[model samples]
Target: MLSFTPYENPTYFGILAIALLPIVIGLLCKKRFHWYETIISIFFLVLTFGGPKLTQGYALIAYLIYEVVLVWLYTSYRKHKNQTSIFVGAVILAIIPLVIVKLTPAIQNGQQSLIGFLGISYLTFKAVQTIMESRDGVLKAFNPWFFLQFLVFFPTISSGPIDRYRRFKKDYDHVPDTDKYLQLLQKGVHNIFMGFVYKYMLAYLFGTLLLPKLQQQALSAHGLSWSLVGVMYVYSMYLFFDFAGYSLFAVGTSYFMGIETPINFNAPFKSHNIKEFWNRWHMTLSFWFRDYIYMRLVFFFMKHKVFKSPKTTANITYIINMTIMGFWHGVTWYYVTYGILHGIALVVNDWWLRYKKKHQKQIPHNKFTEIFAVFVTFNFVCFTFLLFSGFLNTMLLAK
Candidate 1:
């Protein structure tokens, strides 16, 4: 059987273009062929999760059934009764599979969990968010069919810009007019072209062609060499372009389907501070963490009077939140350290902002200062990427 991961290469896009042509034409005619859309979705899902990856496909199906039932039951319960413990239980149940997947590697000597599938993490985020919003009364109705469509939305099924239930429902339920769809088509084309350059060209150069040579040199040189620095910058570029390119393709495809999915990147390398960097880089994930984890933690701490000062509460929460995020990437020491480093950076960034506000006259604010800030932030971030890359463990610890 022939199969291709979503947006894996130009060939995949060519296949996608043919598959999406009817949907695009339907949208241009001010129509949404729901049946056709669902058909293509299944087709693409099969392409991504089927064939040799059949185990993952089965896992995805089982996970979807599990999550859908969980969400439906939670929504039903939330309608008449709102119990904190029950809500917490529901959230825990929803995340249990993902937790198992993340922990399995460490416990089983790097073995993958059977329940794991591509985008399980992303799916869990969506499911948990849905449950959370249902508890908050933001999501009033939970249609199981629509929920399934949202969950299995093919473009972002493998990875996501992580669409919200309400936002996605709004787009999915409406068909844009011809003029509006024309604009969407224009932006979609532009995004796809840009993605080709970023993913196929630049990412290929940095990740495939250059990174191997740099990695070999860095490994040979071992600790604290110029080659390691080269690895850091090259890997950073590769990570950004590859991920940003994937995001663009996903979002662009969503537009072609007449849904304006959220963007995931915005000139992240140009950010001047760690806080600002989070806002620009992998924006959906950062925003999700802010809204769901960080904000909720702050509220919980404040409600319980856990800390004497707001600053202390925020600083602590920042570390805990980022550490959890790191652990989400994997249950590895490198990932955990990467998260801790970012957490500390965020805390320091907050403190510096406060100090600068109080001593505006003393602290210089000019073009040079701005450039220097960007320079410092970019290097700091790239260094963290080096830790995140696991090259250090390979070089220093491996036999």
Candidate 2:
């Protein structure tokens, strides 16, 4: 069988059409076919992990087994007792594979780790959250079989608008009514078409065509110039269209399958500030970090009295949270720096908002101000994407 990356080409969607046709018809009739859904899932998984990509297939299988068993054991243990250290240990164990996978290239001169595979980071995030929720006594019944399905849900498997366990379970356990299913059909088709425009037409123009010429010009300039500015904006546009396009495909496919996968992008470039941008961009991931990482850190600091001032506690957590997010991109300096910069931006944005609240009469809010905020946020995000793109590192080496 030939392997296909999800949404990589029109041909893959063709095959997906054949596979999903039955599920679509079934849902139309208000009947859910779990077994057939399983079969199609396997079909797509093989189409993704089979053929030349067999190594990733093997890695996925092994990783799933490990996660399934670990979650099972943890859930079993959790039901019997509650202990902080054990829960923490379970969470750590859940993430160790991801940690090793991330660190391998850093230490091995850019060589990949054997345990690494596509979607590993997303899977780790899902697993850790499962363990965390279980610890909080919220996720009482952890069905290993269903949990496995949730983790490997192929639509969002590769890159995600990561859905939570209970949320997915709620959808997976039922078939939408005929009216709702028809609506989903309409949305699914619209999103996929829109994604075609974004990924193929728009992204092809910006990323495949425009970006390379801009990059070459910027590099030739040997430092900052209008060429560099052009590169920044072009790359930023390319990045958003490409990723948002991918997210559309994932979410649209999930809709067809009667699962309402959360969206990743929502006009992030129009955001008025870093905080607003985070709420708009890669929203599922941002919300996950906010809920799991940022909020947890804030609560921990407050509980421990780590800082006397709430503002200080929040400021410190913002840095740590964003830094971790950056490092999650990769162990590289640029990625880490990108995270730190965003963290700083968030802190400053928060402070400014609070100050504005205290001095509402002094700071004018208007249409022009709104436009200015969007422009500033857009440029700042684009600058960070420049660092994120690693083009600067290449340019520095060339210099």
What lDDT is obtained when candidate 2 is compared to the true structure?
0.93
In model 1, where is the ten-residue run with the lowest total lDDT? 390-399
Candidate 2: worst-modelled 10 consecutive residues by lDDT: 1-10
Off by over 4 Å in 2: none
Candidate 2 at 104: error in angstroms?
0.9
- Candidate 1 Cα errors over 4 Å, as ranges: none
Residue-wise lDDT of candidate 1 within 230-330, one digit each (tens)?
99999999999999999999999999999999999999999999999999999999999999999999999999999999999999999999999999999
Give lDDT: candidate 2, residue 326. 95
lDDT assessment of candidate 1? 0.94
TM-score per candidate: 0.99, 0.99
